[model samples]
Target: MPRASRLAVISAATLLVAGLTACSTPAPSAQAEADGDWTPITIEHALGTTTIETKPERVATVNWANHEVPLALGVVPVGMAAANFGDDDSDGLLPWVKEKLDELDAETPVLFDETDGIDFEAVADTQPDVILAAYSGLTQEDYDTLSEIAPVVAYKETAWGTPWREMIELNSEAIGLADEGDALIAELEDEIAATAAKYPSIAGKTAMFLTHVDTADLSEVSFYTTHDTRTMFFEDLGLEFPASIAEASDSTDKFSLTQSAEQADAFGDVDIIVTYGGDDLVAALTADPLLSQMPAVASGSIVNLPGTSPLGTAANPTPLSISWVLDDYASLISQAADKAE
Candidate 1:
């Protein structure tokens, strides 16, 4: 989901936009790790073996993994970095995340302005014991820099290494909540099944997933046909993918990228449209003849995502926004799918 969007990247200028259904701390409490464990768990990062110092105190998280586990485990990190960047026009994880932290009366961590590049000096000053870099791209330079601050746990196989589930396990283990982490995953699985059961019609339905590119032709379009982050969200509601989308993905060696409206329209029957936005999209549709003609649009079934804000990420899969998001979007998803009729 962190794929580079060709659409002009949000400059270092903005604020944010923003989870998931299941919120849990994993197995293995930090107390367990602290007991008889001087275990040398090496995270193969660009900088090489990042050994954990059992029972991390001051922690810093950058990407999704950074945001999720830290919060779920009841650790108010000393420093934080958002999963992505956008303007305050859409709430980023900050507001929602802050709410949870506030509920616990935990001290809020310092958030990195990702647009301006990660601030190593600020992180170094925190003197963190363990660093959760799971959802981050540990560039050679960044890695070198972060290692100086603390032992960094980067992705194992790829940049944002490992599946989301694995990420939970590993990050949880790192924090010594392995048991809690496993249970959290279980609860999430059950919730997903129940969610899917609620929208029986969404199953087998086709959907077109895209984010606003620019003022022009809606910029970049990402069409998901199968296993991916957005898929879970749609599947939870029993939503289906259009035939055209299935075909485009069929031609891809990896994930397919949509470049134009023609490619976007490939899923002609894409009855539902879910994307990141504020009113730019709603306004755009009303202003743009082409977009206004989308079958989903003509049928009045489009759901313009709440743009970037502190809690907007709730529509996505993350630890913080999951609980509140469902309550927020339930009406929208049900109505959108119902309108496809």
Candidate 2:
């Protein structure tokens, strides 16, 4: 949930445009590829099922980080939602995404800005053959509207609930690259496992993911639950979520749980604390009378991640992002774990 609001806006705009463009364009071509006999494939999701009758040439992506899946599989989308964060001077693309596009010599695709809901005209102009939002929090209405323009593949169960591996596999299958998707998953898994092996100190440690709010009374403190991608990232590194956190969590589906300043003592048992904010966040937490009691903060075993930094992007844990931040992220966790030891 590190960048949830940004993601929410992007996804909401995608759904809005899909509705507006439904009646504006002619249906996509029905012709199966003439070069190869592309078999039809059906993908089931939370909203409904979408069957691709042929290999789609123009792919469009909506929602957070779903575009990376297609890019990682060597397919550049015809259009994609613009990233509002972590893009730093590269138009609407993250650095890694731009690098991949350069490697493929592919022109930068059309980027839909979601500052004021869906830009129906822009999305329609791209003329995408298929729209992928398999990691989004789209509603049933959103799916219905999008399906009118082109086949839409939505998240499998809960919106934004698909694991990173499933997101890649589903998107690849949507683009007729299921085998390539499996290979990509295996390769990334190997990379993650290899990175974890380098950080032997991370194993058997109890870690917590939290975010600091710049508030007058420190009222915005939040702790991530097992449902969050950041926690999953730690699990990949062989760290366990502290039992104290599980007992404190209130929502089953949400990624994080909020706590008042008085509850800071709840984090005392956590060996390592991963958080996002500015440099002063550690100081702020330690200054809080209640939070200072926590051992991790007392000993300064806290990792403060910048909101737009590469490690911050890894906190959201997409297929490409995990690779981008693995080495640095692992080293940071190892250093924090060492403090606990």
Candidate 3:
């Protein structure tokens, strides 16, 4: 079953040559031996602070893409949330993650696959020393429950609201690899800079990252806000969010804002309408009287994203997803910007 929160749209190819060139080798691990003594570290988060007495050898990750951080940092998690939305038939692991595991010659980590919510039993079965969920939407109850088994490191402020960079930093710190985390972030940033340079057309364009839902009468129309990772991904690419989206947004934590069809004209100023769906979604929106009026749509500046594509995986940027989608993402944005021009 597709998780509702797993909503996004985009595509990607294999890691770009530029990204590979920027990060020539895997980042070094920050285990207790490498970092000298494992000094106790205290981390403040939305739930409260969690203190780690020493470097954790058995790390377990919950929530979207949290496992990637430890994997990218050369640490294999003992357990992790299954890739509910994008996993192939191979035991709930994404291709990139599976590839990394193969390269490390590490045993396939235990996967927790509870669709309704967190699988506490499966997590506890791993007997992890620490549980990393710095980018998760786990509530206080969930945190308290997980804390019973191991120290739980949750998000900093809002649920599912930590930025990609912060997520990497927090996860790195949890595993006692703060310096390697910083280096990894710098490398990813360099890749983003190189991608921007390669596709000058995407810079400075105003974009709206939205999810279109066509109800019985074309009443449901909405877009994601700056709080959403998909929109943040556009900002990473140098695309500006239009003020119109802010005016329409009502809640900071809500992934998207659903508005009345009468207010569709509010989207008129956006240069690009980036959405997730099939090609027919474009046709559906273009046929709607209210939606067709938007400047981007009328001008053919709409970019339809496939739900399970690499670009979609990148809609919620992770340490690994960014590199996987950067080059193809740049090309998609450039194509839309050209139509807008």
RMSD of 1: 9.6
Pairs clashing within candidate 2: none
RMSD to native for every prediction?
9.6, 5.9, 10.5
lDDT of 2 by residue, 247-326 (tens): 76544777777887787777778999998887678878788888778888888888878877656766778878778888
Model 2 scores what on Cα lDDT? 0.79
For residues 1-341, write the lDDT of model 3, one tens digit per residue: 24222211100111232244347533455344544678999999999999987568789999889999999989999999988876646468877788889988998899888587887767776767799999998999889877867788999998888899999999999889999999999999999999988888889999998776663467768788888877888888999888898666544568788778798887777999888888778887888888888888888887777777656666678888788778887888889999999
Question: Residue-wise lDDT of candidate 1 within 291-322, one digit each (tens)?
Answer: 66677767767677766553345555655555
Model 2, which residues run further than 4 Å from truth?
1-35, 249-251
TM-score of each: 0.74, 0.87, 0.87
Clash totals, every prediction: 51, 0, 4
Q: For candidate 1, give the lDDT.
A: 0.62
Model 3: how far residue 79 lies from native, Å = 0.4
Pitting candidate 1 against candidate 2, the one with the higher TM-score is: 2
